[model samples]
Target: MCGKGVNGFMKRIYMDHAATTPTDNEVVKAMEPYFTQKYGNPNSIHSFGQEARDAVEEARKKVAHLIGANPSEIIFTGGGTESDNFAIKGIAWANQKKGNHIITSKIEHHAVLHSCQFLEKHGFRVTYLPVDKYGLIDPDNVKKAITDQTILVTIMHANNEIGAIEPIKEIGKVVKEAGIYFHTDSVQTVGHIPIDVNDLGVDMLSMSGHKLYGPNGVGVLYLRKGTRIDSLIGGGSQEKNRRAGTENVAGIVGMGKAAELAEKRLVQGEEDKLIKLRDRLIKEITEKVDHVLLNGHPKKRLPGNVNLCFEFIEGESMLLNLDMEGVAASSGSACTSGSLEPSHVLLAIGLPPEIAHGSLRLTLGKDNTEEEVECVIDILPKIIEKLRALSPFKGSWEGLKK
Candidate 1:
């Protein structure tokens, strides 16, 4: 409940929970013992090692329960990027004999997109599907794009920039009927939405720990039983030889704890509260601001996401102004380099460069309160007004009037 006070003039509020969240205190507490007193390699056969091994398994079960998957299906990795790589590259390489074609969307995170690009460089064929204006991928497109040579279809459950929730169940049904493997990068949706791997019919799913108020450097790749995928990192026999490396004991433990907490919150219906807060923020912003447009599906977005595009101002400038005001949010994906190219995801949805450049993403989290939402609403309009006034395009508006 503790957060920065609203200074009205200077107090900053954090609305960018989608980008990343601070590790919860309870998760941190669960991880503290593993980092120091109980630290032991799980691979060791000694009593100390057995204790660590027990914790890892217990954590594994928690992560599995969060997504309605069996404990055996969970494989820990260095985070969402690694899990994505394993799902895309690992599956493509292992199933190369079956076919070399892969299907994914243009709105995917760089992790999945770049992995597909890497496969293409090595002679694999990949089809980048386009999304609707709401950023939702059409399952029919997947069906149309599939061929006898199609080996895998990788799509994200929810977009990071605009929070567009894809129709995973429908997409999964098509992929299943086609007998092609379906991989979903659920980094943004796993903790925010209800995810049942069996119901999703996904052969593989990827999730990042930090997105769920857990420690960073930990991720889970849920490979359905009997799914075929090669090991990306080959070394010692760990993760049943599917992923080889020393287990990130503390991070895994924290991720498991966070996932368990997220499940509990879901059961208690905290989602309704989050959705209300998000909608309120969106309503207030759009009502007060001129030339602003909501950028994603109105009803099909994450409960905590509110993405908008304001005309004339640039995203980086808005982000900087918000940061200076103590409000922490992101203009777009954190993975993009310093190119400032106005988010490929935004452009993929058919947004013009000027509007896309003015995008702002406000993602809520468990720790955010209603007061914080009000504070952001009160402060954001003034900032946008100031930025638009200074923009070079503002002069163009005057010329048009003349």
Candidate 2:
């Protein structure tokens, strides 16, 4: 809740929860013992090892409970990227005899897209489905894309850039009927929204700890009990030989506590509050800012995600100004922000490169408040106006108007 920026900015407001979240105090408290006094590899045979193993299994159960899966189905990994790589590659390699074709969307995270590309180079066929203007893939497209050679369908439950929620359950039913494995990168939606694997009909799903206010370097890939998937890493019998290397005991413990807290908040209607705040922010921004286009489905998007395009000014300029003004946001996904090219997600949805470059993503977290929204509303317009006044495009348009 502290908003102090590095350059002595008095009021720092973080609106980049989609990139990562601060670890919760309760989660930190739950992980304290494992880091020091009780530290031991879960594979060891000593008493300390037994204690660590017990804690890890208990954490597994907690994560499983959040998603309506069994503890044995959850295989811990490094993080969401690793989980995505494992799910996409694991299924492709395991079911190679059945088929070599994989179906995924163009708007997938690099983790999924790059894995599919890797498979493509290894003699696998990948079908990259396109999305609508609202950033949603049609279930009919998914059905039509399924060929006899298709072995896997890997799509994201919610997009990280635009926050568009995919119809995973409908797509899952199609994949289920086709007898192909289904995997979804639920890194954004898992903790923020209610998820039930059976309800979504996904055989595999990926989740990250940092996305849910847990420690980093910990994630889970939920593989249904009977799903056929190979290990991405070799060696060790950890995770029932499904994943290798010793477990991150403390990080796992923190993830469990974070999951439990998120579930509790859901039951208490905290998500509803977030929705209100998000909607209010959007409404005010649109009403006040001219030439600003809202990206993604207005109603169906993630409760805390507000992606907008402020035309005539580059997104990097807006971001830099926002940072100096003590507002933390992103021009795009953290992984792709460094690229000079416009965001692929925006381009996939048919945005011009210039407009795409002018995009900004403000994602709220549980700790964000209405006061923060007001502060942003007060500060952002001035920044945009100043940037627009200095823009050559704005000057040209004004000259033409005159």
Candidate 3:
């Protein structure tokens, strides 16, 4: 039983790990000392400053180790959004002499899509490639999209909304054969899955701390050695002049600890446990519920992602009911939560607007237990039945069926 609601009858179960995760206790402990005891400017020339600088460098090594990259390749930034902006804009600006074209999938997070859109508004040309019904981008499509003018290929390693893991290695090989720079917005897959820059054949990768149970404002942009990219900011010579401004020392420390823990957990078989819970949740829900459509690739998905669209009911109404029952979930990305529009990812994958509007995403986490999954599975069907009973759309659909 997670947390009790106001009525004390329902337990608050958080199933929105994809949106953001609670900071691990060890991460908080790692960050606490940096906040007060080691509070010194890493750039300053003093003993205190050197201590902070050493901490930052150590954190960088940890982050690099997690991704199987050199410490020099990791550039700390404000967060995933900034890292994405840096990768897209930096590559474009620095490689204008090579080309002015970028390639990306239509179902990427807004960080990637909006960054590409921003470049499109400028002189650069961006090809928004289409995804299959499972939100998987074909490597053949990527090979076809390439041209002499294509400077960079930025695709996400995993889909945040639908949990479709892209064939990045295959795409990377295609891009590599063409001698084009490749980047991946791996904010969702960094800690959840094993990633090696060399194995993926990616030149740059973006990652967020919060997505992996670390501090919110810390992130890493893995820029491979000799990858030509301009700085997103212009001030101090931080992050090897790739990203400017004073570093978030405490946040970086927390992120490093989080990365270490994540790697350890993966080695100890955390993925298997999460996958079991995720599959159980999906199985129970689909078996008990009717008119439900599963999203994303069946097997090639994140370990804990369960995206489903219930017919004849609005997702927001379902979410509200779930919240009352003490279950926290998301219809889509938290970045686009307030928008009335259906999820772009769902729409891209061929879901009609009505079905897209009914999408529900339940992402499990490390702390989630089988009991929580059972509770959600037990109560969710009742909630859906209640919503369908009250929905005029469902009533009309039933009449049509009769």
Candidate 4:
């Protein structure tokens, strides 16, 4: 059993790792000194400041190592949203004379999607590519969408809601062959999957620290050498003048430690463990629940992701039921949870509105155990049954059975 909270509530089992992870103790420890003892602005000329600056550079190197990027290429930002904005808007603004068009999928995180929308409002044209039933954007569609005016193609490496891994390498190949910049919002993929910037042929990638067991308020944007991008924030010279702001020293340090730890775990076969647990959870749930469909690609998905849609129930109800039982998960992206609309990602993948409304995402993580998986499996079916009993679509399932 986990430790009780200050309110004497038993700790809930967290299955929402994709939404955001708790900062690892190791990463917190690595950042503690920066808060007080080593607290100095990296921009200052004093030795105290130089010590902080050195720590920031070391963190940058660690982040670069995890993604096979050079340290100089990594620009630290506020978080994934800021990184996405910088990658899209920064590139779009800098290259506006060359082209005023961009390409992206309908299933991207709000950060990228909203940035593209903002660009469209600014007189730039954007093509929102449609994904297939598996939430995959075809390379052929991407090829056809590229026009002379197309400056960039921004797609996410992984769908935050459905756990669908896009064919980024193939998409990158298309963009590279067309001589256009390819930017991927890799917030969900960076620490969870094997990512090498060169191997993927991506010109830019966005990553968030909180998504990978690091501190929030820190993110990294990997801009391939020679990529042209304007600075988002104009202030003190930091992040090579590409992202101008005072350095987030402690958050950057935590992110670097998190990246290093994730890299080491990847080498130690962490994927295999997560995959096994993920598969087991899916198998048990599917076996116990009727009229349920697994979303996303069966094989080509994140190792820790398991998204499903159960017939005849609303996702919010299921979530509330699960939460009452001390299990924590999410119906869709954490950013969009308060909205009444069904997940845009689920809709993009061709799920009917009713089915999309019933979606649930359960992402496993390093700290998750088999016992937790078993507990979820045991409790989930009962929750589903109760929800279905109260659902208006209950008749639909029965009618389908007949």
Candidate 5:
């Protein structure tokens, strides 16, 4: 890891919070006892087991409190993808007799998208709604897409790649009115933004621990009481039989601690700091560079998110250049970063494939400083300039290359 040109300072600047955040020290300390001192199966009935069970239930309560959910409604899962799978497939399987139809947007995380696709192959019907230029799913469009057979409406709360916050509350009203169950894959928004399951009117929602500075391999599916859903992993009687697997005690404890910390941060208005940094990053980059498009809604985006697409150069080239400067960033969702294809979310939002290929995503976190952002703002323009100079896609702007 390094930063900037020869004379420039070299320091590792991590700006990829959407991918994952460093686990908070408090969260790690909370989990340490569970891993060593209190190791026991939560399903056991003995004292050790009861202690573990108590810890798990307490953690469940914390997670529920974070999102205004009842403790009994939280079903622990392996991660966000599994939580999403449980929400989509579990609901689809359980409610197959009610209807065979599902509604979701095209720009959803692959976890939701692929789950819906799998349902389609199994004699189910899915309506893949389109998004506008800002990656927003119109509530009116959702209303129009409903049918008598529509059983579920699964939309994302926020887009990971573009940081576009969907009209989830509005869509929730539409789904509730139609008597269809609603689910939101809120992996990108859960800990980063203020959320209330009741206010959102969602029957089910998905979130991952790692996305909120907790340990990986643990997540939650917040299923509103009485929402008919089947277990995705059926073996043990864990997660109130809604999900079956041995609980990850340490991870769950970490998640609970992380959730507590996140809630405190939100209540303290700490996210406003992220908003300032995010806005500064966006404002400086667009002002300093030319042929750049800021992706997602200008204001209705994640407080820590800044996604942009620079024209005339490949995103990979810019990423590599930035890496040499010791600034860690990404072009899109970390899940699909290895793929050679342009982001589907970018295309869904009306960006051409060439333009989409140049996208960059920078998500801020509590540890990030204004100075670090300033460093990125300083070196990024230089990287983009050098890349553009060597870019073969340069057209009328070729005369500026030197």
Candidate 6:
């Protein structure tokens, strides 16, 4: 992780694991043969194709195993966004006869949000449920949102921006009792946490490979058996006629290997280790800085997520300063980067526009170390102090008042 910084060459600390991870060496090796030696279309009928087909099925099983789903129920897609679209639109269209109503939350990823918006234009009704100050969607809200014409309810297992873990299982129970289909965008939680589709009581779930140190071009949709969903793509009978496309052999193999490694790491207590780092970052930032607020549920959030809103200083300025010092992070959801507007997730969680503009998300990974955490803790305060001094609103800073 060494890099050329503003001062000199230094260690580059990555704190944007939620955006994507550095693909594991093992995953790269597993995918190497497929790009050349085992190059074959899984849809082909020849021996080369059969070999690829076998690898694809094996990868599907690995992905399913990670989430306690059946291999037969797994549907390979281009990425998380595609899986989300397939789930939301597929169910809405396929079961339109049953109802035209759908339910989701205000703090969902763009993939889910855009999908629901698209459905709303095409005669489908969608209810965007609100979250609490901590960004947790109330299960009772989901229960109350159901109508006679409700068809599906889509929510995320964990928020990508704030890392607030939602009550999917409880919401799942509510949807099930109403006989409405339920789907979850588990892209942020899938590889990082233990998940069981049956336990969550979800009819469908979406995940991306890159979030788990796998290849970037692959993802999966766990479509439980007997779920009514229409196919989005229609060219070949691939993916069991659910998602039609030739499988991404190399990427799929990489994702499968990554899934196995993620499962092993989770069972070996890697999550607890991340929690310690996350807490240290939060604790030090709060104690050493003024007018800063933690952005998510302190205990119910992800093990590796630390979102902080530092008043008076802008997030982009802080990110630029951190990058110059060889520390990498994000102001908000990576997908929404480059936008001048404040983060929608922060706003949804009740932060004012000025405070939301100051939010920063630091997501940890297995590769991060305590030394790195300590370095960040030391460097960040200096960066904040420098930025705050330059800020026009510095006179109003809580530290100045204190």
Better-scoring candidate (lDDT), 1 or 3: 3
Per-residue lDDT of candidate 2, residues 1-402 (tens digit): 334545764777999999999999999999999999889899999999999999999999999999999999999999999999999999999999999999999999999999999999999999999999999999999999999999999999999999999999999999999999999999999889999999999999999999999999999999999999899998999999999998999999998899999899888888788899899888998899899989999988998999998888888888888988788999853233777678899999998777788899999999999889988988888899999888888633454332
Off by over 4 Å in 5: 1-10, 333-336, 395-402
Deviation (Å) of 393 in candidate 3: 3.0
What is the per-residue lDDT of model 6 for residues 40-78, given as tens digits with 9 covering 90 to 100?
998889999999999999999999999999999999898
Report the C-alpha lDDT of model 4 over 194-253, residue by residue, as the tens digit: 899999999999999999999999999999999988988898777877878789899999
The alpha-carbon lDDT assigned to residue 250 of candidate 3 equals 97
lDDT of predicted model 2 = 0.91
lDDT of 1 by residue, 1-402 (tens): 222454545555778788889899999999999988879999999988988999999999999999999999999999999999999999999999999999999999999999999999999999999999999999999999999999999999999889999999999999999999999999998878899998999999999999999999999999999988898999999999999998999999999999999999998887899999999999999999988889899999999999998887778888887887688988853233366576889999998776787888999998889988888888799999899788877633443332
Clashing residue pairs in candidate 3, if any? Answer: none
- Name model 4 segments beyond 4 Å from true: 1-11, 333-336, 395-402
**Prediction 3 TM-score vs. true:** 0.96
Residue 26 lDDT (model 1): 98
lDDT of each: 0.90, 0.91, 0.91, 0.90, 0.90, 0.91
CA RMSD, predictions in order? 2.7, 2.8, 2.4, 2.7, 3.1, 2.8
TM-score of each: 0.95, 0.96, 0.96, 0.95, 0.95, 0.96
lDDT of 3 by residue, 1-402 (tens): 434645667667999999999999999998998888989999999988988999999999999999999999999999999999999999999999999999999998899889999999989999999999999999999999999999999999999989999999999999999999999999999999998999999999999999999999999999999999999999999888888899999999999999999999999988999999989988889999989999998889999999999988888888888888789998953233777678889999998777787889999999999889998998899989998887777533545342
Cand. 4 TM to true fold: 0.95
Residue-level error in angstroms, candidate 4, position 1: 9.4
Model 1, C-alpha of 23: deviation from truth (Å): 0.3
Model 1 bad stretches (over 4 Å): 1-11, 333-337, 395-402
lDDT of 1 at 226: 94
